[model samples]
Target: MTTTPPHTDPVMHAIGLAVTEARGGDPAAARRALLDLWERTGVTGDPLHRCALAHHLADLHEDPAEALVWDVRALDAADALTGARVREHHAALSIAGFYPSLHLNLADGHRRLGSFAAAARHIDAARAHSPALARDPYGDLVRGAVEEVADAIARRDRAPRAPAPGPAS
Candidate 1:
């Protein structure tokens, strides 16, 4: 038998309110609400709330590249954050896998920026992070997307580098 911490409920309720606001077309307000929740709950190390915050940040960004930064922050927050409060969240995500989504989104962002090497690196990270991604229901779509991007990066790399664009003749 297991029991949830008392603080967990409050944090979840606050996160839910933020998400509801974000989904209801007021992302800025949602972002503010989540930030307040972070401050109130001191949820820096709680993987669930950190992931939610990161997703909120990503959703608020106009640029995919900016969103990638938030995605990476989310991963880092999960990886480095420490506290008894987050143990269950970490354990659950470890069992479920979290890295592939981070790497795939990062790779997609890098691809959009024409950063082939970076894109490939993140794709490789995605693959390395979740070798059995194809077998995981939650990771399958990201895995497929990463495979396509990886293929595109390989093709791009094999092609000769074009002459740098200069002033028109």
Candidate 2:
């Protein structure tokens, strides 16, 4: 899984902590915590929680195919999210801004699986929606990832990206 670092909203504090744990090198503990939260959230629960949980969970997996499953779930939940709902958590965020990273992660996963056609399609979507990203470091990070994934797809490289959060173990 590859995406820009996630944005933390006050309402998502628990998730933020688990994500921090994942980044801090305790993936097993983080995964357990996240899964517990996922259970509480339920399958048809809040789209925001579903999106964030699936997105972060995807990055904890070492298998590309497994990561892709969570990425797809994240995208599905993202599609159900609304701007109003996102704004409830953080006024600075828009649902549109989430697409680039979501698509980027999917692209990277597909690229690693040798699904270049799908990878190209998703990379194109990521680029097309990238202008919605803020003119800040967060935006730069996602855009940079978009470029890297695109490059990898163009070269038909299936090897994982170095230091990639998931799909590299």
Candidate 3:
């Protein structure tokens, strides 16, 4: 007879399950389930879950600033993960987290909200994550544009600010 593995933390399991559901288009249930799972697990400080929940919530709300926060959290979690599966998860997230699809959505949202800088940042992040764009003809063009935008942002950020004048004569 085959033996089944023991179940892990119920709340963590529920959060994972909730994320799956959210990805499948059940936003309401996913949100409720994630909140319940977090409450039950007392997992507010878990960077991974925090990031995952934040990203999914941002997606549901079309909020790039929120999503950006989550993305940073996710990167922190990735750095701390020590398991084999964690490595795999990190690899996947590193590639998928800044995918053009989501980045484009964020850019559009930011643009509509009059956040040109945020929109540009997302495009830059998306391109940075897509280093292998040469393999995809269409993606290469999009990546090229993203690089240009990033360059422009960098130039603007680097431009020298005028020095303050002396206080008194």
Candidate 4:
């Protein structure tokens, strides 16, 4: 049975609290809490912390464009976590585990902005790098999100576009 390191639990708990607050209709408070956590982590903290912070922050933004910025940052931070870097915090950390969710979020963000091509690319990446853990709820969630985005894209494609206006008279 895999277990999260004791040291990482506090951070995870804090993130969960912030997420709950956001989902409970108090996004402003959630944003402030996440921002505070981000500030505490700074640039020199563990890559995992930065990745988590950026990922959660992305969800707080009402604008898809702005959310995409945070999603990209989360992916960057996750990608930068080498074995040595990850060992500093989570000795048994599987860096590959982060890619699926990060890519899934990016796909959703891109889809929201009507960037179907970019969204498809990220969706493929998510599928390719998905974690192999058994009964991982987060992985299931990512898979569901990928399907949702794909469906949205399909619906958009089937939508008829209005004719373009002629040049001014």
Candidate 5:
């Protein structure tokens, strides 16, 4: 049987394109595209779109402070999302699944910014929320990241992790 691709919203398509641009070595274009989409998404637009766009936008920033702002936006948007709403994009998605990665990013950013206490809090939160993940590659990936960031916090490492962020991030 031939399985069909899941239907996606235009905003998601645009977000994907912008991410692709960043991965394809045109971060300036990617930033512009995502920023324009952010304006379209507005402050109270679709929670899923806002969460996704903000998350990816954070990946594009090397500055911990700027990235922290976007990561916080992603986390906030995730809180506003619902399973029913996310199911519109992917039947397998859960808002609970979003927290591990969101908190991981925040933890990493805080660690980089010398906010070890906050980083520890977020890393612990990421671990606490990790059981919501499926035993798939995505789950494993986030779990690995949790460990990595936790170690960074423990060492009080205030440097950016190698392979910092981009399309692949």
Candidate 6:
């Protein structure tokens, strides 16, 4: 007898396809696809899909500033979800586990925009929410990025400031 694979949410499936397309070299197309999905979902879509779409959209932006906007939206969407809703969407996933990555992305976006204080705040949030596992590749990547950004901020602080030019003659 033939058997079918387990069911996955259609929204989640579309997100996976869009993300794959984005990674395959047509970011614009991927962005368009995601936007379409977002419109279809409207304000009442599952929080999980909203969060995932916003997160992916942030990465597709060319400007870090624009990316930050999407990142904030993603965080807001995630925050709107309750633990039970999260469990309903994906039994294996926890809402708490999503925060670290969201914060890490925010930190990176802020760091790219030279907002060291904001970046540091998000980095701290990421650390606070990170899983206790000894070795998660995603966690390690986020930690490494955090360290790099921290060092960059430190160097910027230590660098001598150039004297401001007086009024033009």
Task: Quote the positional error of residue 78 for candidate 4 in Å.
Answer: 0.3
Clashes of each: 0, 0, 0, 0, 0, 0
lDDT of 1 at 14: 69
Give candidate 2's error at residue 74 in angstroms. Answer: 0.6
lDDT of 3 at 128: 59
Per-candidate RMSD, Å: 10.2, 5.9, 13.8, 10.3, 3.1, 10.8
Considering only N, C-alpha and C atoms within 3 Å, which residue pairs clash in candidate 1? Answer: none
lDDT of each: 0.64, 0.86, 0.49, 0.73, 0.88, 0.73
lDDT of 4 at 52: 81
lDDT of 4 by residue, 29-146 (tens): 9899989988988866767778888988987787888889999989988877886655555555567777877887787777777788888898888878865433555557666666
| lDDT string, candidate 6, 65-154, tens digits | 898998998998999888776666656567887887788778777877878888889878887887632356655765665566566555
For residues 1-169, could you state the per-residue lDDT of candidate 2 as single tens digits? Answer: 2222334443267788888787888999988998998899988999999999999998888899998999999999999999878777776679999999999999999998999999999999999999999988778888988999999999999998754443210
Better of 2 and 4 by lDDT: 2
- Among the numbered candidates, top TM-score falls to 5
Candidate 5, residues 18-57, lDDT tens digits: the string is 8888888898899889999999999899998899999999
Minimum summed lDDT over a 10-residue window in model 1 is located at 160-169
Residue 112 lDDT in model 6?
Answer: 75
Ranking by lDDT: 5, 2, 6, 4, 1, 3
Highest lDDT scorer = 5
Give the Å shift of residue 81 in candidate 1: 4.5
Per-residue lDDT over 1-169 for candidate 1, one digit per residue giving the tens place of the 0 to 100 score:
2546434566666676776776677878987887776576454556666765775566566676786777777777657654454455333334225677677767766776678888888989888887645475456666766787687676764322222122110
| Superposed model 4: Cα runs more than 4 Å off | 1-4, 7-13, 83-93, 131-133, 157-169
By lDDT, the better pick of 3 and 6 is 6
Per-residue lDDT for 10-105 in model 3, tens only?
434566677667667686887777666545534346544554454455444434455455444444443444444333344323334335534544
